[model samples]
Target: MSTQTQTETFVLHNRASPEPVVHEPAQEPEPELSPKWRYPKVLSAGMSFFVAGVNDGSLGSLIPYVIRSYGIGTDMVAVIAKRYGTTFAGWLVAALSNSTICQYLDLGPILAVGAALQILAHVLRTWMPPFGLYVVTFFLASLGQAYNDTHANTFVSSLRGAHRWLGFIHAMYMAGCLVSPFVATAVASANQDSQWALFYLFPLGLGVANLALLGVSFWDRMALAPKRRRHVAGMSGGVAAESSGKSALMEITVTLRTPGVWLLSLFFFFFLGATITAGGWMVEYLVNIRNGNVKDMGYVPAGFYGGGFLGRLILAEPTHRLGERRMIFIYAMLCVGLQLVFWLVPNIITEAVAVSLLGFFSGPFFATGISVGSKIFAPELRSSAIAFVFVLGQIGGSIFPALTGIIASRVGVQVLQPMLVGLLGAAGVSWLVLPKDAGLHRD
Candidate 1:
């Protein structure tokens, strides 16, 4: 079929209502992943998240090790922060390219490319490459994550009961986080002579499995096809290419024009900043200030991730029922309160429990935001809008941690508390700032 025919069919299928597609008055209910074939695809998406969780989660536990082994920081943590700063470039590249790539590529091939890049990154890290190479791996891994996660989110949100599925996949990510500390800490601490970098081997193996699952599940759609000939309205050759380029550019323009997208992106921005900062630096803080053993403190982050796992599993339905706006703000405030407890209560056990509860409360923020954004944005723009949102979240995810490293290099790791309090409060306020309900976007 011609590109115009495809565009027209999209309109016919999607233009049924002026209101949001989720609430169609007197129409049939939204389709769930009733097709038996889709089960494996969802599983692949979850595995992809799990693989990412392993890659991202292990970094927190390994930070101390990465520092000591490489002599990254002596009096200050500048080198580590500089390393995280590189991840921003990867996410930026993905944000700038996502919409154009989506216009030209099929889903399966995009996912495949992402999976492959991640695997290559892990492979590069397995041998304990140089410091520069180690930092470069973050860029490759992050770029892969951007492609895989943005598309997976876009695909899953398009399904029925997206909240449940989004929670499931994200929870799987927490599960990976939960498990990674044990593995990473174990590998890094097996003996006094333990090679900290060897912990990457585990994710390398998992990345391989993830790629295999993606290839098998997405076999039918997997491809990097040649560009299509555009014959629409007598367009030919360079003119067709120019028109395609123009239309692709317009998608990004429309997504940017929507106020809801930026509002939603703000929520993710602060939410991720707090999360990555907490997870990435919690162990370092414990060791530096609390005088906790590095080995034991490494495992402490598991409590936070495990709480997040259970929270996403348990709270998804309740949040959906209680209302996204009201409940998310409450959860964000709860997170702030828990963060205070974690910060002020000097006891190690108290800090652990508080961080765990904080994770529990913040768990739904990601899936909930995706659910709302999926509904608010037009179907055509969902992929681009969410890609933009995900990138912004990542920008926070990278920035705050790097910033913390920069500040902590001088003042001390104790700065984590106030930074987190401010971020959590900001996140709560941002939630309140969003439209009170998803239904408001109908039309």
Candidate 2:
């Protein structure tokens, strides 16, 4: 996920110069700026990830409450499937539109729009909207997240020591995931009678703050690009639109053609799918099969996320130091063992500890993948490629959860274990399959 050590430096070619700088350090020096004032935008981007993490993290804790509040029946299959289906749709829309949108607009307006959509979703949810509308809110939230986060990640992963920054932002995400369950569980159980949906008020407040942060930090890039950027300079409107469309199409085509993109996507496909599935259903499994209390079980996922928070913080540099490929595979194997402990062992306490440890091992997976991807994907295709990978990963995130819910609605949530095991193992194998030499056009 990170660069090789000082002995094996990356040779970043200067586009303006003919010579390559072979002696540059793998860990790039911090940008020369005031000590107190480096990149606040990195913090802003991290907050965006945190907001998304809050939104996603809450789901695992809230799933049981949603089913109970909705008074769902055998059609629970439809309910869960449809809920995640909307999530799938949101990612689908992002996949189709992110590249085109970036072609004409700056990241500022795009991020602003994404934050606004999330705020809108929370607004609708806090009122306890109808079931159908509630599902629609997920679509809005995810679409917003896709836009807001994909770009933020792309921007961060391009910097010096991109791995560390990627870890910071993604670790912020785990922090949100960690904080969310505590708040969600507290709010939900505070007045389980009628205020479960009130949990959204929390994310709603954060969403507003996220938008303000993005606006202030990204002020310069908030508007659409210059006319020359949107089109050929001096071209008429119709031709400009055509030119923009053609350019956007070309980026997507090129991004898709890259083998490294798809290989990374494969790793993400299973990794995200497994994590989302486990998080989304762990509460349900504990409550049903483990016979745990609904109120108490809601807090359990905090352990998972908390472990993840520590893992991302503690593991990023080491993973880089040891070797991203070998270390990730090792972590993946550890996760499989922990998942087995969660499964075979009947003690709820054992399961809880196991899940937490499982999370710790799995946490580095995301930041590491992105750091490596930045090196492997072409710069021109960077934004669209990462966007594609992210949305595809979100697709995996949505699909497995929906599938689990659908199957569990029939066979019970016990199936979550085997599914997770399989996906985790698949993720390990996929990581091993990545090209050993990590850099542009390694495909």
Candidate 3:
């Protein structure tokens, strides 16, 4: 059932050697990177996702305490929430900009910049600032994340065993999310007022670690850089000034004209929305509606992320056997059922189980879509496609979090369960329409 084939090998003999040197026939570019086991690249990328997960999960868990510390109303908290949310928005812009610049620059430098930004932003957040400063700092940090994310997705997807690698990266992120609640809570319990600041230390450390790893691993890997071609806009022979203006727009026009990019973007829109909404809302829902204890509430989100790890481990081979389309649809349907169980049931334990099941089963869908996009688009378009989809997904992430706040402010946190069901349903529909062997398409 495997779509993969063993490559043919050719033996070569040198004048100095009695034995032949065998070289395997180079295969079509893999959907993942060469030497996928290159430990450093994997480690760096995993830490990146991990930092993201921890940041997201801890911030959500810390929201109540932050509101209390600032002596602000829930409305003021929402305004502060924009600071965190703007990071994602800035990520979108960075992705687009990186895609254009990747033509002329190495992805490593871009990622390094992002890591530095995260360290600076987190440091600023820990120092206690005005709401506007908080938002601006995160936005700047998020721009860096966008660069790292798009390049990382592109780089990782170009390797072998993509599903497993993607899963590992995402699982690390979940692991970060899983750990954050406990860390944040333990800190918060001690200080009571300024606990959120303590959580920044972890990402600050990770950001530094990632910078070192990236410098060593990819410092000289620019051969893998996206190819750049110069376009001339003169009409046979024209004043250079007249042609310069038009060529600038042409760069953006080329990316916008690709159909495959737009569809992939739509895919990311739904997928990221589902992920962020679930991660951001689940703990709050449990604590608020189920009257779950804050000390115990840490486990609920961990369970969700734990489920993600399992999904990644179990589904990698099966997805290859069954194909991406069928597997995605199956998981999507399963998520819907799980969400219903979380919603209709009133028991906290049962809700926790359902939420975890939902998180575990659903994590692969987002990572898989990225793999699919890698296969479906041309290499020239791959990062841009990734950027397009990722941006849409973040837009979804932004909208759902803000919406959940509104809903929680009005009807209650329990609304998240039912609303989540609808979102998962939409994701399944999107998967159904996704092209088969999507990664194979030349366009």
Clash totals, every prediction = 4, 0, 10
Query: What lDDT, from 0 to 1, does candidate 3 have?
Result: 0.64
Error of 1 at 51 (Å): 0.5
Tens digits of per-residue lDDT for model 2, 334-376 = 9999998999999999999999999888888988887777677
* Sort by TM-score, top down from the best: 2, 1, 3
- Show pairs that collide, candidate 1: 18-443, 19-442, 19-443, 20-442
TM-score of each: 0.89, 0.90, 0.83
lDDT of each: 0.76, 0.77, 0.64
**Which pairs in model 2 have colliding backbones?**
none
- lDDT tens readout by residue for model 3, 128-169: 677678667768777767777777766666544555666677
- What is the C-alpha lDDT profile of model 1 across 1-443, one tens digit per residue? 00000011122244332112211222432333326657788899999999988888888888887788777762333333333556767777887787667545667778888888899899988887888888888888888988998888777665555667788888988989999999999999998976878888898898989989998887755643223222344766687668667866887788788998889888878888889889889999999999999999999999999999888888887787776677888888898899989888899999999988888888888887887777676676777788888877776776777788878887888998999999999988987787664363222
Q: Given candidate 2, what's the lDDT at residue 333?
A: 98
lDDT over C-alpha atoms for residue 136 of model 1: 84
Q: How much is the lDDT of residue 401 in candidate 2? A: 77
Indicate whether candidate 1 or candidate 2 has the larger lDDT.
2
* Structural RMSD, model 1: 6.2
Give the winner by lDDT: 2
Name the better of 1 and 3 by lDDT: 1
Off by over 4 Å in 2: 1-11, 14-38, 73-83, 226-232, 438-443
